[model samples]
Target: MEFVILTGLSGAGKTNALHAMEDSGYYCVDNLPPLLLETFYDLCDNSTDNRMKKVAVVADARSGEMFADIPEVISKLRLEGKQFKILFLDAKPNTLLVRFKGTRRKHPLIGEIASGSIEEAVELENELMNGVKAMADYVIDTTFMNPNELMERVTTLFSAGAHDTLLVTCVSFGYKYGLPPEADMVLDVRCLPNPFYIKELKPLTGLDEQVRNYICGFDVMGEFLDHLYAFIDYLISLYRNEGKSELVIGVGCTGGKHRSVTVARMLNTHLLENGQKSAIHHRDIWKA
Candidate 1:
């Protein structure tokens, strides 16, 4: 079983994060009191057989003294051999103030936040939160990130592991013309002889076996596959460690329609097989 404790300043999107975690299959509890920490752990301990693997708890100053005892509670959980990590979210004061104003809600730290004046109470709360922040395993700045981006980051952390990297690949090429960009990696089967040159294959899609075999016949094809697989695996590990959000790998050949489509599909399959999250777009494959 794994646990994630989320704590942060008011209006930092803790609620949104909790929802995202729930969407990702985490058993989530919002605003749990610190005193119940022991009982909660015990309940989870006894329920490990029930397959409740991922649990998320939102703990913040709203719980009064429960917030103050957070450190000791965390220590106790650690001593009890529970697996857990802390995630802290922080947003700029101006952004937070604007959010509160837009929602017409008072700051949890300050009773009523004035439009232009910075709230001293909120500042004090932040000061008190320093201890928990210091203990955070992951701290996210929400000042510039949107909800979708934040969810992506959170999903990567859990699904991709602590060291997995996120790669965003944009593949583009013209159907009538040849390959597209200077891909960090390129696979050119243009010389494997275009099966498109054949009358039957010319009308058929790259999905046809004759076209696939024609392209794969080249020795370079097998070699490219071997090297590409190894390189991507290494990159997955590398990007995760570097906290990379995206990587783009373009596959192209003469005419994006057939060759590039087939290769991209193959590569996409391999990526999914390796347990990496990915998406594919035909780009110019269907352009007018």
Candidate 2:
């Protein structure tokens, strides 16, 4: 049986993640108590129904005092020879605050559990969840992700037979728009020639054939790409050996409209050709 423990902060989209898991054929239970986890696993493991083979449970801070028992429960499970993976969903405190304000939902720690403002509650929750986060097999930061993107991420990570290898995401962004906080590696491609200088290529993005051709036309681009590919190849092997489940590579140039997008696409192509699971996002492409 495959058991997945889904836990995270109050406004980190754990509910949406659970729904995504359910859609992906996982039998999901929400807000399950830590004390009952062992019994629940036994029921699923001993059940005659094959549909119960894949189980996902959401055990978050809402369970009050019972939540404190989760670490011990996990330890017991490990001792019993039951293997499970913990996926922790998280977002920046400001993002969580915005989501809470937008939805008008109360923070779980704002009531009898503790007394404070929303921001204070968020801070307290983070401190409380630190231990669980440290033990997480995967930590997903969803601060900048929309619902569809979050669903895609959850699907990619939980997809059958896809979790063995590390997933990579190459994001192209403008330096002016700030760096992607989730990036594990940031590569600056600003040293390359800027296509925005060319009158014809100025209006076209890296996705266009003309802009792509112009960007790759430089000899330095080729040499840089060769080294970048080799470095990424070496780095990913080390990350996989270190049990990293995902790697986010940020490729940034001046405006993200030209050079960075081009190199990001090149990296995406390299990963694809090597039979790796990767996704590319042009974060500031449409920004003026």
Candidate 3:
């Protein structure tokens, strides 16, 4: 189980960091009081779902006076051999001030600090957070970072293994058998030449080298693949940057036994070769 405690000054992008972690597959909680660290981990650990194991929680000045308990919880967790890392996000006072004013929201510590001024609140919270900041495994100064840049840095620090990869599932189905319900994108390769017309190729599925060769023999196949690959590549970049994790692409032909299977396999291979995780399923290969 990987645990990360995300803590920082308010208006310093803690919520943004938590959102990035969520997109990276972490089970995330926002504005958790410092004292609940252990209990939160306990609940996550007890859950049967593997997805629950990787957790990140935001614990910061938003907790009011209870935020001071951060260092104590850190010490306790360390003493108990509980594995976790702390990420502290911070920005310059001017940057933070601008952010707070731009957003037109009262600082979390506004009423708690003396004089009830947001400026004083920022300074006080900064002082209070110093203890946990000193204990942090990572401290990110997000003063000049845009949201995408911050997300990239946080993701890089905690990524298990290219964690945000868009998982691609390619399915080959015959038009006669109906479309795959799970498909997010569907392509019709029915326009492609059919290998089933050839006596030798007819007996072999797309898995056979001869059938693949026959399919590849046409000039149109190469052109079609080039265009489809380019189109999918662009679409994938858009989807991936937008935080989409899974894509089901259906390749269809008159019969799933040949062209559709070949096209889906080709697409899957293309994705895998490019370091993307992909799977191919010939849904109606045996329907013939």
- Highest-scoring model, TM-score: 2
Once fitted onto the true fold, the runs of candidate 1 whose alpha carbons sit more than 4 angstroms away are: 48-51, 111-118, 160-288
lDDT of 3 by residue, 13-128 (tens): 98878888898889888888888889988888799999988889888888889988889989999899887778889888988999999999999888886687888988998899
After TM-score superposition, the amount by which residue 202's alpha carbon in candidate 2 deviates from its true location, in angstroms, is 4.0
Pick by lDDT: 2 or 3, better one: 2
* Candidate 2 lDDT by residue in tens digits, 1-288: 788999999989898898889988899999999899999999999999988888999998899877878888888898998867899998999999999999999888887444558998898889878888888877777876788778777887787632457888888999998888778889998888888988988998988989989878888878988899999999999988897877889999999888888889999999989988887878788888
- What would the per-residue lDDT of candidate 1 be over residues 158-210, giving only the tens digit for each residue? 55432234543435344354343323445454444566577777665555677
- Model 3 lDDT-worst window of ten: 156-165
What is each predicted model's overall lDDT from 0 to 1?
0.68, 0.86, 0.83
Best by lDDT: 2
lDDT of 1: 0.68
Model with the higher TM-score, candidate 1 or 2? 2
Cand. 2 TM to true fold: 0.88
Model 3's TM-score against the true structure: 0.56
